[model samples]
Target chain A: MPEIANTAAKVAVAMTVNGRLVSAELDPRTLLVQFLREKLLLTGTHVGCDTSQCGACVVHVDGAAVKSCTMLAIQADGMSVTTIEGLAGASGLHPMQEAFREHHGLQCGFCTPGMIMTALDMVARLGPDLDEATIRENLDGNLCRCTGYHNIVKAIGAGAAAMGAGAKVAAE
Target chain B: MYAFDYQRPAALADAAALLKADPEAKILAGGQTLLPTLKQRLAQPTALVDLARLPGLSAIEKTAEGVAIGALVKHAAVATSDVVRAAIPALADLAGLIGDPAVRNRGTLGGSLANDDPTADYPAAVLALNATVVTDRRSIGAGDYFQGLFTTALEEGEIITRVDFPQVERAGYAKFRNPASRYAMAGVFVAKTADAVRVAVTGAGQSGVFLWEEAGDILASDFSPAALARLELDPADLMSDLHGSAEYRAQLVKAMAKRAVAKALA
Candidate 1:
């Protein structure tokens, strides 16, 4: 185990981040967001409210969306962790990200990364053809302080449709 | 957050042993609540024995009695589990409404029940469904599980293994959630079995989650929203915060109860 620093306690964490396997020895108190930003230097995962309230720290742990700020780095040991940066491929942006940019879903862009991650997860869970009320209700965890979320909701709907079409193409 | 010793024991026996050895040890079930508290410096534990690595603790199955939900079962799992949705749709619905998608994905049944936050949504379901909380040592009735605000019948070092909610004829949960944080301001859960009816209220209790005996009695007789007409809660024991007054919550208790009853009927 590669220890990071000299501390009373250090937890060895080895996990698949994005598509790469990364390992580090960190303090037991280090949140998953801290591990992503400080250790891996994947700053795409923003930490808005250190408290779990704001969804700015949302990430996919084992394919499920969870607030990274509320999770300890050691807790995600051996789990596949996906941050916002993982969404885009080499050639193009992820459908959700493209949709947000196309629809102007953000202003300050602080909450965009979490929003996209959450939106993609929502589509995965709820399916492609999401209604307006369902999309609004599904956005309980994510909050965009800018643009009043009108465009964000619209972008998610369009993104869901695009993802469905993309899946169809892949299937074909 | 303060640095602490972290142990992820693979076996339930080992996890229990780790907890028993340290006086200031805390069990990390989901880290949905404990982590936030630790970040705020409200709690400082010497060690956290994580139970998420333990196998067979996330199973959600329909049993002869009811739906048996393992302690490690996440809220999203309960909400989306076909077994849970089929056996107890209302329970699934209630789980679906807890916190938000991200929170639900990580939060677990054991963590919620063990913490017993007064504003929590699971206690209402547990109380109204008359669920049995199965621990490593013994099984506790839902009525006896919740003691007070942020308190439970769970003894130190004891871990909840599973929660068994009896299959009901019909059940419903309704809540007016806090806009910022999805925690319920006032929530009600009503469940009707072949022989009995239950009405449990959460979020507005000063002493924490409790059963509305009067409403239960009324619903047991007629089982309708109108049955709660004469129901009036004593504001003296209800919670009052910046969100709402005790009087406001008392009124909301009745309103949510009515809506829950209507939903169950629907």
Candidate 2:
């Protein structure tokens, strides 16, 4: 049998967030979204719904898109997490973010961060040549109260193309 | 989400010891359902033994029999795996029809089978395909594995290590999903082996997933969509809610079964 430890009020958690290694002591109940928004002040990841239905809290965990609201902060220990804040680098904006702006994908801009995060993960998995049906089907987790999905879909396609071109240029 | 001790044991023996020590301790696998249930205060576990660190439980391997999927394998992995798609395309298709891409990324096959949600899609496939539920303690056949809603043959401290699915001659699954939750309102899995046929219906059953022996018998002889045309399911044995009436679910079960049979034949 394994030695059992007394229950502690808080546990130490360390993880890589947006290319930087960070560590913290947190209550066991602290969710990943709460840790990101309240502790790190990376509030770009929204909480449109506390329930897991809304993709407003979507982020990339180890290069795969996952619902942040459904995962505990401790569960993400030692893993790498990429949030909306992580997208911009030396480049002014990510291709997906630029495409959203170019295509007028947002009215309230609440779901934009998650949309962009999910779009990037989609591009990573499905490649840059995404179709209308594929984008619509993959967007099942996300909900836009403004119902600006038409523009959102358009932005994802354009962004995917730009990302492909950017990768090509980088390779060249 | 009440306060609880969290442990990531490196070995299965240590994880089992943790669960044995605390009866209220829950094994956290992927946490897609448990975390949501915790947030709602629906369950109060004293500790969460995370299986993330446990090694050798996330692989999908093709075997001489069929395919053996590790318990910690996520839904997305199963849905996108070339091995699974080649061996059992129906299983791959079923995995793809789960909640969404994000949910699929975090949810696991072991987690789904352990929860045994009546509206889940895995139960149907597990039953229809005659898969084996392998745990730390014992190997349970699909016939003896599922008991009822949110119930399984798993004992306390018994962690499912993997599941072995036998390759069938042909199999297919179809479900009418609840628009809001995307859970199946009525789902059917039809499998045809060398000598036998199996039809498992989920979501519609009041008790849980069950084999439609009559439909299986009819298909065993005829093996076509038209073979199930004359069959009818009794509404009294089904579930009824705001989303659908018991009568509605009964009809859906037959319709989905027909579609599954057609897919298998196709």
User: Using lDDT as the measure, which candidate wins?
Assistant: 2
Q: Interface Cα RMSD per model, in Å?
A: 3.9, 4.1
> Model-by-model lDDT, in order?
0.91, 0.93
Model 2 agreement with the true structure over B1-266: per-residue lDDT tens digits = 66788888999999999999999999999998899998988987888999987999999999999999999999999999999999999999999999989999999999999999999999999999999999999999999999998999999989999999999999999999998899999999999998999999999998899999999999999999998899998899899999999999999999999999999988
Residue A15, model 2: lDDT of 95
Residues A101-161, model 1: lDDT tens digits: 9999999999999999999898989898988899988888888888899999999999999
What is the clash tally of candidate 1? 0
TM-score of chain B of each: 0.98, 0.99
- How would you encode candidate 2's per-residue C-alpha lDDT over A42-132 as one tens digit per residue? 9999998878888999999989999999999999999999999899779598889999999999999999888898888889999999999
Cα TM-score of candidate 1: 0.97
- Per-residue accuracy of model 1 over B50-81 as CA lDDT, tens digit each: 99989989899889988999999999999888
Q: Please state the i-RMS of candidate 2.
A: 4.1
- Mark the regions of model 2 whose C-alpha exceeds 4 Å error after superposition: A1-7
